[model samples]
Target: MAGSNFGTAAKIAAPLVLGGAAILAGMHRWESQELTVYADQLAGGLPTYCSGRTQPPRPVGERLTQARCDAIDAQTATEYGRAVLACIPADKLDQNSFDAFTLFAINVGKSAACGSRAAQLMRAGNREAACKALARGPDGRPVWSYASGVFVRGLQSRRQYEANWCLTLAEAP
Candidate 1:
């Protein structure tokens, strides 16, 4: 019977695994692809490049080919996906939920996303609350929309968008 349960689980998870390409394509609209390295003055001059990537920041004015940017984006998505998945059970996640969480992780770093109230609610099997938590916390205020202790409008918009994405499979008002 346990083997049968595993098979059932695999069947449920198959679509999510197969939807990787679609998710990647959908994410493009949310992530801007800049071929040249630039510093994000909004985030205290955080060096960024290649679709909002901010790791091993390249020197300012450095340029990369579209192919290289694509590669880096793919690699970063995969890395962040693994990190997010490590903290959330695969069995509990629909493709939309996973994509939303992965997007959040990409923006806020894996540790921050994984440790967030959203992740906690999801892990506790409360999908509705989890989606709402992405936008606001227990205080009924926006969360994760701050940079250097100041609220950022763009980040707030992104968080609300991600929250809506998370509610795709759920009935939300």
Candidate 2:
């Protein structure tokens, strides 16, 4: 009877494990979509922002092919993901947190993101504080503030989104 009960438990657990994996995969896919949309909005598709040389020198402001645009977008997302993974501890991140950090890093650059107060807080296991810290720049000003003291609406909106993602309890995607 004990052996039969163990087999029954295993049967139940197997489905649960598979279901959890499916859910995680779905979450990752959704997160990737969100990142692409946000990045496309930030970086227009007009001219390719290629880091390396292309076959033909694609000058700035020149229109890119649809295929080229897609390739660049995908490349940017991959680079940002790699940067976030390299800078942050794996155990400290959830999907939303990772997404938020990725966006922030993309905007502010890897050095700033890695050295941020939020990163420190996260490393110390203070997620709430880390979330709050996302609103400010490296200079301690609101992220929207320019070096000349002007505030940009777009930057403000982006910071708000990042903060919301950081603070929200729900998993992203």
Candidate 3:
């Protein structure tokens, strides 16, 4: 029975690892798919399009097909996943950690994610510490909990989720 349960669990989890399903799901859940370009006040009024995309901002009034938007998201997620993987060894990363840090890099930037205390702990092979660092700074206040100089409840929630996700597969420090 235990073996069968293991098989069932593996079947469910395999696709997530193979297709980067965790990160994709997080992106879709948090970044609503938008067909038209608009200014994202959360992103400091940067022009955005197609599921929170800001790079090479799409001109206003331009619309994107669902397929195009999905493609862009997949491409960006892959790029950010690679950046996160560089901080921690692939062998040490599970689906949860991969999702957590990849989502973090996608929300923030590659440079910020790569230079964060979380990344530093990951580099030092302390997965638990890295996970804890995602939510709280040295002063214990939530990290990445503000936008445009104002506290954002949504960001705080996201950070808390990410930190919890990071810890799911990590061993205790």
Candidate 4:
């Protein structure tokens, strides 16, 4: 009943609705735990950038190997994630939004994702626009070639996920 159902689609959707449903039906209670596991696998646990690491750069549909992405994800959760959550407004966020932002924060350093123009828009209460801003990517600069290895691809996906999560809040009874 909680957590926006890619992340699920991408990571564990099959189980939630199919085979995984039994184990994850009440997973809302364990989202934080799941995040730690997820962060440890994808983002390098806050090491700075995955570009220089031995792992392949993140791309859509890329399958992250446990050996490569695991350590990074944990490092990300420790370094940037905790701080980002600390800064996020408790009243303004839900489990799904929190999950989405945490993942985005991992993709683009906490400072970049949380303080960029995009995040500013979200904080100012314009998530619809903020979601659009997420894909704009560093003044429309090229992510791979820019000084900031901070491209907006992965973060954009997370943003869209967050947007979807937030959008649903409006339809809630």
Candidate 5:
């Protein structure tokens, strides 16, 4: 009877362990998909600042390849994801929230994201407030005004998406 009981416990425990692993794997895949979506939204290469000088421009039109653009996107996403994970506790965020925050960090710089009111709210366990805070800019103005003291439709759209993601639970892509 004892041996039979032990066998039943092992059967139950095994499924639980496997289910937990599958959930974790799904989360990882979801995070990767979010990164890819962000990269696609950002599009291909544009000159970035380096020592106050613009970096070399990427080949335009025919000279630019999808593979090359993908490589750049993947590299940039990986860097941003690492920076975000370093400063934020993974357990504190759901997949959608994590993706939104990672994108915000990518756009606004790691230090700014880490120090922002949104991050503070997240740390304080006020996720709903943090989601709302996503709409605010570094200067506490709306993101639309961050472009050039005028409302930018694109910025507003992006902020809306981020805020929505923060507020909703989304499935893995």
Candidate 6:
């Protein structure tokens, strides 16, 4: 306790830091609704932590190989994760928040959603505004696509849910 090295200090402080980050992240980030809906949009039918499509979009494990099959799974998740995380600057988000946010990013696609005003505002450190920005599209038009709106809403929901989960975890024995 008195003379701890990095390992001891890190073990003690890491949870505290993670808790604080989760609270801060939940403070202004998306909710579970946004994440789930967005996930559904992109997944179409798939669920969380998905891997190896039952009927892959393209050949795998045979011509391309099982490694490719697994790669496809990882690639999908990673792409979405990058997109979500990219929407917000690294400094602004904590670990748990980032996990939830990544769900949204994966579904919406970094190029499409992050390019929107929502991502722009989020990256600028105004997450609430960024979320509001999602209410509509670049055309300044109503969210004509239900899938689009659901995707945004789901992402928002997931962020909140993950943040809440972190809080719960922090309180656990």
lDDT of 1 by residue, 91-169 (tens): 7677777888888898889999999999998887777788888989888899999999999888898899998887776
Highest lDDT model number: 1
User: What TM-score would each prediction reach against the true structure?
Assistant: 0.85, 0.60, 0.83, 0.43, 0.59, 0.40
Ranking by TM-score: 1, 3, 2, 5, 4, 6
* Candidate 1 worst ten-residue window by lDDT: 4-13
Which whole-number lDDT from 0 to 100 does residue 116 have in model 1? 95
Assess candidate 1 and give its lDDT.
Answer: 0.78
Report the C-alpha lDDT of model 4 over 58-161, residue by residue, as the tens digit: 33334445544445445544454465556655444444444545545554566777776655665655555554455555465322212234444543444555
Winner by TM-score between candidate 5 and candidate 2: 2
| Prediction 3 TM-score vs. true | 0.83
After superposition, the stretches of candidate 3 with alpha carbons farther than 4 Å from their true spots are: 1-19, 170-173
At residue 135, what lDDT does model 5 achieve? Answer: 88
Expressed as tens digits, the lDDT of each residue in 16-112 for candidate 3 is 2522667788888778988888888898788888767788767877889999988888888888888877766665566777789888888888899
Return model 2's CA RMSD, one decimal.
11.2
- The reply for model 2, stretches above 4 Å from the true place, is 1-58, 137-141, 147-149, 170-173
How many residue pairs clash in each candidate at the backbone level?
0, 0, 0, 14, 0, 24
Global lDDT of each model? 0.78, 0.53, 0.76, 0.42, 0.52, 0.42
Between the candidate structures 1 and 2, which one is better when assessed by lDDT? 1
- State which candidate has the highest TM-score: 1
Q: How high a TM-score does candidate 1 get?
A: 0.85
Q: What lDDT is obtained when candidate 5 is compared to the true structure?
A: 0.52
Rank candidates by lDDT, best first.
1, 3, 2, 5, 4, 6
For model 2, residues 16-94, the per-residue Cα lDDT tens digits are 1111332333223333322111213233332223322132335555555556644654555556656766777655666
What is candidate 6's lDDT per residue for 41-158, written digit by digit as tens? Answer: 3455433322323333332222444455345545554555555654556554434434444534444445766676656665666543444455445465434134523644554455
Which of candidates 4 and 5 is the stronger one according to lDDT?
Answer: 5
